[model samples]
Target: MIFPTQYSMLSTEALKSYLEEAYGLNNLGCKLLIHNVSDTYLLAGVDDKYIFKLYRDSHRKLDEIKAEVELLNILKENGAKISYPVTDLKGGQIQSFNAAEGIRNGVLFSFAEGKPTHDYYDSRLQTIGREMAHIHNITADIELQNPRKVYDVRTTLIQPLEYIKSEFTELPEEYAWLQSTTEKVVEKIRHFDLSKFSYGYCHYDFLPHNFHFDEHDNITFFDFDFAGKGLLANDMMTFYVHFFFQVMLKKQSQEEADKNFQTFISAYRQVRAVSEEELAAIPYLGFAFWVFFLEFYQLHFEDWSNTFYNLRFKKERMGWIRNWVEWYCRF
Candidate 1:
């Protein structure tokens, strides 16, 4: 009898063979691209490339995986520029593999042309804003048959704080600071007129890495791993975080980053109505983003980021959360 395993890495060669047979494609090659919360592989054929993502049972269940496929299909059908799932010979979008950790699901996605860029020229900023607004228009008021998370004060702020408390047993002061700041954030959000906000399925991670711009400057958005129900402004908030980091690292002046963000907002307004109230709440919401990811790192440390998740990393994350509060939050 074999010992039970917690997690396992699938063989690239076996995956290549399986995919070729399942999709009826010849001359296929597979290589692991990323191994974070999920495993991503780059698949290349004679003339085309594709991405295959294998999901962990602990991260996304079958139902949530189906929801992602459904969402991307809808977006593609509506002409939203995105990297959607590709069907196999049986017209199936999902493939299952029995790994050491039990049943794992995988999906092959259409390759998004071009590469990701950090330098967002004015024209590119406008493109991002317009594209994001177009996605929001479709995601808003739509319901998925499968379950997905909802980002709220409980999930992003309160619950994450609770989940990470055990991990901070050795750092009491930092944990206390986190609790104190969360209270301030919750109170500040309490005063907002949330009814003015547009609710939708937001791509929680809208950083430059999740999108690509081709030679002709056309953009295609991918990686819906963290898509969930939330304020549509949450997408804008994630994009804004890119600029915040630029200013923090001294790569761009605060004034310049702010101006660039404004350019994006203005373009977004051209397509959809965004209120001053929702915009004002971005800084507070940004706090939730940090806290949520901090908890995420702690939760998946053993499985994904074991090499980097240490005491020093925790303290560094605490500093980031602190900086976010001092630089952006009020009260």
Candidate 2:
């Protein structure tokens, strides 16, 4: 709901037509899923069930979206566990249309069954780790036909700050403090010798919500909306940063945090090697992304026009971000 002027949820009628026009399916039912990053609609008809995604803010280009679909196919073909994209009637995987904002593209994906993990456990952490390793193993070698963004210090850290400045012509003192802290954090990030580390396709957003577990406990990774080229270790660090802070927010013990980290790292190493140096840099990388996320919510949602700015909604988040930063800098 942040950028309503630039983005709107896809209506049922339009969503159905999109499915029909692209995949030649009719009488499909549509349900609006969450609206963030993209507007996703769940569609169902007779024997067909699919999840349709409409890119928001036109943040991604058509070729970038195609690269995601292609990567999904590549991972599946290589025997990596993933929910692949469904081809349209024209054998095309993406459907682009002119909307109010501009040209928007949508893709039909086979529904991934199973609930997103909310209760953190070591076993689930290990599962996510192993699957990501499997994905990186194949994605590293495969050459993508379409281009994707690269996740690096510039993209993940500096660009977010630049976007913030664009939105807030005059930075608040809190925002100014954040800027100074971010630069110091960026310096810490620069210390990492990325040349010797793992590199290739990183699931820039490997948060737990992007994948689901089936009845057999097998994970089917979906939502490559943020897929891009980068250091694979960065993917692990992203998850590490997110999961750690989430647990801290819940008042969980360090033991619980340590257990999840140990299991996840150990399981990933079972499938692929992570060097000691890469392991050490995880906390720094995690902090970099953590700062990036804080800047993201502020830049995107702090204005009165953004519903996310409502005091009640943003209060706890600011507290959490502050505490996380203090803890990170202290350690």
Model 2: lDDT equals 0.75
66, model 2: CA deviation in Å? 1.7
**Candidate 1 regions off by >4 Å?**
none
What TM-score does structure 1 among the candidates reach?
0.98
Against the hidden reference, what TM-scores do the models get? 0.98, 0.86
Model 2 TM-score relative to the real fold: 0.86
The candidate scoring highest on TM-score is 1
Minimum summed lDDT over a 10-residue window in model 2 is located at 302-311
lDDT of each: 0.92, 0.75
lDDT tens per residue, model 2, 1-331: 3344566545788668767877877788898876766778889878877898887544678889889999999998898888788888778888776676667898888888776775657777788888889999998888799999887788777887676665444436555766777787778767778788898998877777888887767777888887888888888887776666667767567677767778888999999999988887776676666656655566456222276644454445546656656765533
